[model samples]
Target: MKAVLVGILVGLATASPVSLHRDPWDPTIKLPSPTQQLVWGDVNVLHTTDIHGWISGHSKDVYPEKSWSGNFGDFYSFVTHMRQKAMTKKSDLLLIDTGDRRIGHGLTDHIFDPKKANGQDA
Candidate 1:
């Protein structure tokens, strides 16, 4: 466990020094990408909150939105890599997701009660 913790600490140390910048064409928009080595520390944690069923990731088909898009698959890969690193040094790395779930999405939102003849378009 200590070994794992140490690994996690090392990975954490190398993470989080991402560059946050806006597109020159669109200053209102922002993009986040790791650009340098992160500061090391004794403890580290990763938490995700207020995500409304967007695990599928940002859309690339849509214009101007693909710049910062990364899907659940990518996220899993990152976590797995971190886990491997953590296992090496027996360090600790906790990931928490406070999901809002899928409620306002298109398919669910379009669900109409067609069972009754009450008439609502799905």
Candidate 2:
């Protein structure tokens, strides 16, 4: 009975590695699109805050993480597209970043000198 249990444990341990063959970085995965059409008014405001320098975005293939995919470039493209739409419609589109642009992720952490605290790189 002990030998059977030992063999089962060994088999489980060996099979555990196979189950862990999932890739964290899937390049083929696309970012999700908006489900519903947005109702744009004369004055449209796009607000972004507390980014903490996470420009690369969440790459995990999980629930909330997958929902928030797309990096800074993707966001910029989206803003550009919206701006174009607003221009064609003669509407005012405002993009606002309410502070907190530094000191959180790897992109904004430890990259500057000790003198720079608030992303002031001279």
Candidate 3:
């Protein structure tokens, strides 16, 4: 039992940083581009959904939640840097976001000041 636990911990510790999604480095792997004449057996796709407006990440210093402490600003910076690096390496990469633009959180719910309640800019 102890050996199994240790193995699991070691395995997790060395996992790749990239998720199962499109490896931002795939295009630079020297593989031929997909062609009409050739068929591929397997492909990988990654999806992130139901993000809501949690772009700023949970502010509360809670466990697990705090693990994803990256806010939208951090995400934006990360994507920008990744895209630039991919471009330099001639890699094909795509970044996408799902729907649900608004209607949550104090910022959205408190569109108008509760004291005013007249749609006036506070």
Candidate 4:
């Protein structure tokens, strides 16, 4: 019982809450005016490349690859939310994409059946 109580107390002290709030009029906390701040002094950049059709995630269900299969739609939503958060915190944020943009998939290939020769009989 004593050990469990100690563990609970330790966890509570070390845990960080998801959100924090400060009193707006607190004299010690001076909000910086726009003119006094450097707009891009400290910036954060995110880059993704060679993504291919991975927007739907890799098909293989193994370890790290399995973990990433969460899909591109989730990633886009995450980025949108994070950018909004960065803007709220008055920080510079940039996202970049690079490399080949082609999508290779059965859906794309089947658009024109290969069995038909020269748009005529197979």
Candidate 5:
């Protein structure tokens, strides 16, 4: 119970709810300003899961979906920045990825295989 609460708090601190500019192509996309100030604790952890080969990002510019459409590289940059923030604050932050990277886009799920059915498995 406490862990869940901590997780929520940690997430809120690290991200602005809608963190990145997911779709720069869309002209009408409205991004919200980050209002939450980070309150780093002694220990913190960030976990990402259920990616399903979406390590790239959302290609189509759809509502709500576009909010989290940044690629893994973007995510890495975000985490790196946050980690730096934690270091300045003298807090410990850990990043954990529990995603099952399978079941994804054509480029990843298909592409090179002769069958094009089973991709590079874990």
Candidate 6:
């Protein structure tokens, strides 16, 4: 776990970032590609956290906001590819998501009327 985190940090630190999506609504931003090739072991973990209800991801063309343009479908595609890679390598891959379901963002917070099932309608 520690090694994976370190690898990601190093990748982020050394690589020139880029954006993956080219949606009309999303701002043009470069996606990040790791400078160093990531090492895969017999067992691997792919983790995601926070999210803060950014299912559609950041649409604004601002600095940090534009970076996370890939949405849930993109995330699913990535996981699928990773799973296929792990299968070919005969390794175990696990995906974990720490909580924080619906907290921020207008999609989750403001789209639904609170009076309707305490936002369960969302």
- Worst lDDT 10-window in candidate 4: 100-109
Which runs in model 6 stand beyond 4 Å of their true positions?
A: 1-33, 101-122
Query: What lDDT score goes with residue 70 in model 4?
Result: 58
CA deviation > 4 Å runs, candidate 5: 1-30, 101-122
State TM-scores per candidate: 0.46, 0.52, 0.42, 0.45, 0.55, 0.55
**Model 5 lDDT per residue over 1-122, tens place:** 99999999998899756555455446785666889976789998888776765678887667567766878899889899989999998999999875442444333444544344345441
Minimal lDDT window, size 10, model 2:
16-25
Q: How does model 1 fare in lDDT? A: 0.61
* lDDT of model 1, residue 44: 52
Worst 10 residues of 3 by lDDT: 38-47
- The better candidate by TM-score, 4 or 6, is 6
| Candidate 2 positional error at 118, Å | 7.9
Each model's Cα RMSD: 20.4, 7.0, 13.5, 14.9, 16.4, 15.4
Quantify all predictions' global Cα lDDT against the true fold: 0.61, 0.74, 0.57, 0.65, 0.71, 0.74
The alpha-carbon lDDT assigned to residue 16 of candidate 4 equals 90
Clashes of each: 10, 0, 0, 0, 0, 5
For candidate 2, the lDDT comes to: 0.74
Stretches > 4 Å off in candidate 1: 1-36, 39-42, 60-64, 101-122
- Tens digits of per-residue lDDT, candidate 6, 1-122, equal 99999999999999996766354434464556889987999999999876765677777886556666878889899999999999999999999876343444333446655355244555
Evaluated at residue 5, the lDDT of candidate 2 is 100
lDDT score of residue 122 within candidate 1: 25
